[model samples]
Target: MSKRKKSTTAFKKANKFIPGGVNSPARAFSAVEMDPIFIEKGEGAYLYDIDGNQYLEYVNSWGPMILGYNPPQVIEELEKQLQLGTSFGAPTEVETEIAELITEFYPAVDKVRMVNSGTEATMSAIRLARGYTGRDKIVKLEGCYHGHGDSLLVDAGSGLATLGIKGSPGVTENTARETIVAPYNDQKAVAEIFNKYGSEIAGIILEPVTGNMGVIAPQRGYLEFLREITYKNGSLLIFDEVMTGFRLSRGGAQELYAIEPDLSTFGKIIGGGMPVGAYAGKKEIMDYVAPLGPVYQAGTLSGNPMAMQAGLTTLKALKKEDVYLELEKKGQKLEAGIKKNIEELNFPAYFNRVGSMFTLFFTDKEVQNYQDVKECDLDLFAAYFKEMINQGIYLPPSQFEANFISLALTDSDLDKTITANYKALNKLKAEL
Candidate 1:
């Protein structure tokens, strides 16, 4: 086992003040049957834990470090902005600059409003949808997590799936009723829900390409089917692109799939790893937000100058033609390596990949939905996770979470990761 004495001590101390010794429940490592490692710092493609162990990071701060940690350009921009000030609680030119950049990239977004996190982005988008449609209920996929917002917390994947909780404790039954849950990639289930509650539904929200349920992609024409149904129903189609935006492509899944949503939520790479998020769409719907329309949603830290500077720098860097192509090459390389290992080991594992996000499920069956993901062998994944960490690769602690790839990782780093994966799987097989 790796020497995690300092991490262990830090975790113990942290629990006295911070619940579960972590700010996010996903970081608690409860699903992996281990204590969380305390990170001291991160650099390009690697994290240094408090124990002084270096790990090739696959989590990438849960998908925002697309250019990897502390990219010189982003940091330089942030430093320059820091001298100016942090939060204005008002507005800045940088916000307009970033907003214009976002609208330029995403064809679906005619206008956008910034928020502090993915949760706020998703929550605000849903509210806007409801207000625009004059409906109260929303439809969400069973395992497609938007965030921790009360309306979205039901049947959420990611940390909720990791911890085996269906819905949170505090959400009222009435609130749960308003948010309908349907199986992902199941057009029939969605159709059935809409048929029953079509008039009441404000919108249908989903991860365009699911990362929360471990990188499941939409089935053929699945997105088109959704677009058709929502249009027919006179309801809004909301794409919770918090994970997919800018990561999938410059225009995100909407551009990749050639389907436009009425409203879309974005985070992660949009903020360049800073705490920022946004909801945007056609002017008709976005105009429903206050200061323009009747719906009221505001944030004290929305479009903070520091986050705007970092995001602007990151987005500008992403505009380069070769960035995503290079990412695709790296993703394909890593996917190929993992698939080769799985085949050689004859392990009952399946891999899913889209652009730079991927996941390895401990199941022989092809995963298409939450029920399919539930069939994965959690025990095997836990063993593999422990072995990988021991081999100096840091992955997401939960089997249900997607691992991200960053531009900072070299071919050598990928090779090392593949080698570590091979050894880890081999060790697990030997133990069995």
Candidate 2:
């Protein structure tokens, strides 16, 4: 037994101050059985843990590290901003500049409200949708997690028409009832829900490509169908693009699918690893927020200078046409390599990828929804995860999470990652 493997002692020490030794549940490594490695620092496509172990990172801070950790341009911008000031409750031109850049990419986004995090962006968007439509209920797709907002923390119940359950304990049943659950990629089911409660439904929210449930893409025509149905029913469609926004394409999943959502929430690559998020849509709808209409939303730290500088720098750097094309090429190459390795090992693994986001499920079945993903062999994934950690490849420590590749990774880095995956799979099989 390795002494280094038993890092739980540090966690035990940490639980007194931090709940479960982590602010986020997934970071606790609950789904994959291993003590969380306290990362000391990260640079480019690598992370150094407190134990002095360096890893080629595929998680990339859960899709936010697009330029990888500590990109020179982002750092330079931050340094300049640090010398100026941090948070000024007053407006800064940088905020408007970043907003302008975002609006340029998303043609449908007429106005944007900057927020502190993805949760804030999603929560505010839902409120705006409800206020604009004068409705009480929202339609949400199963497994498409927008954030920890009260209305969003709902779980699917027994039947298609059944009311949802409070997914988390603290969320009240009343809050759960406000959100309706529908199966993903099922246009008929969505239509049925709207038909039944069309007048009372405010909006339909979904991840155009669900990264939270293992990078499941929308079926062909699925996105178009959603737009058409919601429009017919007089309900808005909200795209929670926190993961896919800048990573999938410069304009996000809407660009990839050619479907426009009335409203969209953005995070991840927007902040260049800094804490930032935004919700944007048509002017008529967004005007419902405070200072214009009744729906209230305010943030003391929203559009803070640090976040704006980091996001603008990252976005400017990504504007180079070659960067995106290079990313797509690298992603496809890695996907092919992973598929070959899976087949060669005769492993019961399924691969999913879109652009730089990927997932390797520990099951033979095709993963398309929460139900399909629930059948995954999480125990096998845990074993594989541990093996990968030992092999110096850092994967997301959950079976139902997406892996992100960064522009920082070179061909050599990609090859190294694949080789490590092969060794990890072999090691896992021997253990079995």
Candidate 3:
């Protein structure tokens, strides 16, 4: 371990050019009450910071590095494509190949369109939905972050919650009006909205299992209710599976829950860590996009070959092994260990988990929605985050984000983390 003098100096210089010294708000570390640590490299389960400190990385680049940083399979395929070309601004075989793989896994995704990011995916999906349904409004839930797409940011979680911003400026009042926000996990509220605006709603979009609001799972029968009501109302059901896709299961949240959505948006693991996103749906609906139909969208780097190669390689590797089971076992181990610590220490914390994603909330109550998540003691979470960093462990810098568990984590890594967590809880308890 070493001091973060170099990181401090780098962030100071970065602040001169980049806004808040980070490319993304989540990386700003504002919520954690500290300057961000710049990573020199990530190999296997560890991240090495510029200051020469090693951390057992838990963020996993916010859920994309499921195979851990620099997995040989992905890098090898990327190297093969690197020699061929980067981007052609034209069609490539790898793009079709990756899309085909996704289609085979998800019955809801008979066709898909590649895009630059999750924001683009959700944005395009919304446009397509409106065009297809001939409707003017969209429904989104509280705390389910689709992306920075203007229509989807009204009550977003993650960065907005971390920064305490209600919604971004520059978004038109008309755009906000077009979006109807509802409380998550409350089927009654969703049904009431549908009962009133059913005919006007183009679609209802939400994360089937949210990571943005720190890994809140859908209540039993919740997904089915959305699927049924949307169908009955002639409205599209859109699953914002950007974070849960491929990470939760081979077929994503839809397969895990056995519910089919009219449209599904994906990112993160699908790109194998490269910048990529996609929106897909049944052939009848996806045909509404672009050249096939009226709703237009375009991107030069939409299906970059390198990203396709990386995504294909990663997805193929997942198919060859019991990756999901392995991840689940690791997740279960970590959860049990932490829960045991909480019970013994009598800590006032609530833990929520779904597969490899989890959050240790600072609130004592069960966190079912954003209102409950707000009850969390942010100041205590900040102190715990800093303590974990001091102990050579890295976590998501905000209580609003979920921490990842990767396949690269060894038993020793889990052991160390458990011990570190126990010590952190006990130490924080003493200080109280």
Candidate 4:
């Protein structure tokens, strides 16, 4: 096994200062029942832990590094901007440039506001929606995590699910009541909620293609159903594309699915692996945000030069004709290889993939929603995760999280991963 002595020590040291030894709960590896690895550095598709062991990374920094870590072009642009300055807390031309690029790709967005993280984008978007619609309550899909904002913490997925918390303790019951929860992919449940509280609901927010609950794709006609219901109820439809933006396609799931939401939130690949996010929509509705209308959302570092430059560089790179095609090719190869291993081993597992994002759920039945995902054999997944890590393949620690593929991975890397997967499956079989 690769030595993790340094990582273990670092975790101990971090715990003295940082809560649970992680800035984010997802990084704690709590779901896998292990200490988090301290990454020393990442190059291309590989991560070198503090102990010097190298891993073929599938986490891709939780779905940002789509072109892989520190791509030369993005780094060069960021360096040029860093020499200029980091944060200005004022307007910069680059912000407008990136915004233009975003609006161009996502035609549904005629205007956008940048933020420091996905949470801010989603939170701000909801506020804008309520302001525009002049309504109070909002409907959110269960297990489709938007962020940790008080109104969104109810029945969330991701770290909350990983740590076995139903909902946060501090979130007020009143806030929870304002935020209606419904199962993902269950249009009937959404419709029923709308029927009961149509006028009260400000909007409905969901991950167009869910990544929080192991990359569940919306069922056929589900998006259309949501669009119709929201329109009929005179409520806006919000697509939280924090995980799917740019990574799934140049225009994200909205483009691939050809569904236009009233508002959309973006992060991950948009920042080029930096801390950045955005909320955007039709010009008429976005006008409801601060300065233009009454809703107030402001961040000093919302449009930092470095982040804007990095995002612009990444978006330009992705705009290349063959980028998404290449990603789709790589995704297919990886999926086919894993499917082959599952067939050969007769493993009771379900693999779900959408473009370069995927998940391997340790269950025999198809996973259509969070409830289905919960039925997965998490113990088996924990064991499988351990074996994969032992073989120098790094995956997302939580069974409920999705794995991302990057352009940095090579055919050779895919082969090694397939080999490791086979070996891991055999080991699991042997142990059982």
**lDDT of model 1, residue 127:** 90
- The C-alpha stretches of model 4 lying farther than 4 A from their native spots are none
C-alpha lDDT of all candidate models, in order: 0.93, 0.86, 0.93, 0.93
For each of the candidates, the C-alpha root-mean-square deviation to the true structure, in angstroms, is 0.8, 3.2, 0.8, 0.8
What lDDT does model 1 reach?
A: 0.93
Per-residue lDDT tens digits for candidate 2, residues 1-432, read: 123543566788888899778887768776666678888899999998766778899989999898989999899989999999988998999999999999999988999999999989999999999999999899998877888888986753111111123376778888888899998888889989988999999999988998877888999889999999889888999999988998899999999999989999998788888899999999998888899989999999999999989999999988897887999989998998889998998888999988888889889989877788778887898899988887888888877678998999999999998888888887777776
Could you tell me the lDDT of residue 229 within candidate 4? 94
TM-score against native, each model: 0.99, 0.96, 0.99, 0.99
> After aligning candidate 3 to the native by TM-score, how far in Å is the CA of 150 from where it should be?
0.8
CA lDDT, candidate 3, residue 104: 91
Residue 9 lDDT (model 3): 97
Clashes of each: 0, 0, 0, 0
Better of 2 and 4 by TM-score: 4
List candidate 3 stretches off by more than 4 Å.
none
Tens-digit lDDT track of model 4 for 387-415:
99999999999998999999999999999
